[model samples]
Target: MGRSRSRPVRLVASDIDGTLLGDDAAAARFRSTWEALAEGERPLLIYNSARSSEDILSLVDANLLPAPDYVIGGVGTMMTEGRMRTRMEAFIEELGPALDPAAIAAIIGSIEGAILQVAADQNPHKASWHLHDAEQERIHDIAARLRSAGLDVKLIYSSRRDIDILPRTGGKGSALAWICRELAVDLDEVVVAGDTGNDLEMFEMPLVRGVVVANALAELCRVVAQDRRHYLARASHADGVIEGLRHLGVVR
Candidate 1:
């Protein structure tokens, strides 16, 4: 449903979980497409995921997916070059001491009871809390709680099961912007692919073109459809990602 070409892509940003490795079939296809990229033409893979950096790295080690040139972890609250750093380190270095972890923790703790209760009731294992619409209300409540505590926190929707709480000033899109600046790559040159809401901010950026794989949720599909350059693939999961990449002319 899209065109294919042999042009070299400089940078590729992809969401993990549902986008690239939701199931074995998808994972295999994603791996193959990744492997097919010519070494010289291989774009730097930016692994953006809600998973903690440790978990993300562990998965990379276990699955043998090519190590990313950069990893945006904790829903982009933390970033690592070749290896990850503590969240405290990233916050301090990037935004300065204006961000207070203790204050943030206090705010989270204040509403922790309600959030946990709702999460537990929704899923005993707390696996599907993000899929609940009520979770959005909780997020808004949490944000208000933080603001009242003099801590600015941004509630970012990243996936069905997760929402990122970041210092009001930063998020996945912010991290991507930083990477683009560091690499001196124009934002328009980057192609972002993801299957969930967390990837929403990545698409909103002015310089980036987002491709929402076909398996994305209805909410995400609506967002992707708004952009003329954004694409909706006919495939699903890894096949969808490959299709989107091929559409961008990153693959032959």
Candidate 2:
């Protein structure tokens, strides 16, 4: 295992599903690494995931990933120190009338039918409407249509099966920047690692260094190549995370 020799990491931000945990082996290894890092060193482990805070925390408790000091969930529209309900309420207040529950519901409702059609056509095994290649392209088309209708919304591709629709102004990168400012930790000192498209915002930050793990999509590979300083691991899942940590000199 690698540990930082010169500059100890102040914060370690990572995505959950594909980058850190993939199968049982990766989950075990990631849990071991996280537990080892948790005791005494107490470096903040911020789980920046596309999952909701509730879902992320449940996974954390189940797999016993390091108890996250912070969570940036819902593609970064929501952040939670511990409990999500209070922070969510505050965030909703800040959103004001622009993010009324009814408007968001309408957006979701509008897409429900198309999502169902895609699901029926592709994955009959899955009941819920999860994005796939065709669905994502359609979602983009929907966003364009919404924009033309005078609604300002952004459709973000997270995983192959997950798309988040949000106000055009918010995203994971914005959330990371906000956390960095609050912690007084220079974004240059922080590191982010992830495996899917949702991780793009965190990778693109000029102030932050990033690693795209082996499971990343082809689109992400192109983006990572554009920035030579951003590292890509050869290994997949937790092994990839370990390799990335070594690349950053966080572990050896």
Candidate 3:
């Protein structure tokens, strides 16, 4: 007996950086492949990433890739849709007023392993950081302390160096889950792809299938390789995404 290929998925949600956008040729392939997907599988197309909607639109303007049906931006802090690329006001507002970024910075500032991100990189609901390699343990201790203090924020770290403080329940997985419910789409209909630590949540979601690109950080590969739901690609960047789609039977 052999490992079975994945069942065809009805929707594809993918990360942007090393997963989709790359060099000129890769971008062209991705655009053509995705357009074919729109005509063939006709699966829902979504960009699930750490970039803000504004950031993503810049890429669209540059002709790097076509606009996705849904933009899961800011590591899922916001979602936007339609030709106008408007933010889903009701969904973002649901998280309530964001805590002051300075408030969380005050806490991380004292932590030995964490360094706060720049102001431009900060989001109302997300506090970004860069962590020292040897401080993984201290990072946990600090996060626990923050939670115990009832700061009620979730810490998302990936690629070993990046960390984000988010509302306890707001994240890529949670946002994607919300999209499914709002569209009345079944969990089994969705498949996800990514290339770094931040994307772990998308693959970890019990309801979705995971596809990892070849260029993913080694740490990410080690963590996701054991999962039965994940498909590790043979190529890098957009080529890798195309490989996963084929493995999933999304395209011939």
For lDDT, the strongest prediction is 3
Q: What's the CA RMSD for each of the models?
A: 5.2, 5.6, 2.3
lDDT for each of the candidates? 0.67, 0.67, 0.79
Q: Candidate 2: where is the Cα deviation over 4 Å?
A: 1-8, 38-42, 82-113, 116-131, 135-140
TM-score of each: 0.80, 0.79, 0.91
TM-score of 2: 0.79
lDDT of 2 at 77: 69
lDDT per residue for candidate 2 within 1-252, as digits (tens), equals: 234343556777888888777866876876777667535664577888766777778887786565777887767766788533235355434332444334444555576443532322211111123546645467678667667666666667645666565665566787777777878878778888888877888888875777788878775777787786577788888788877777776654
**Superposition TM-score, candidate 3 onto the true structure:** 0.91
In angstroms, give how far residue 74 of model 2 lies from its true place: 1.1
lDDT of 1 by residue, 1-252 (tens): 556332345888888877877777777767777877777778888888776566677777876456677887766666777444333354336733344544554655454332322422221101112323536666677667767877655666544445445665466777788778878888878888888777888888885777787778865787779777677888877778888887887776
Candidate 1: TM-score? 0.80
Per-model clash counts, in order, read 2, 3, 0
> In what order do the candidates fall by TM-score, top score first?
3, 1, 2
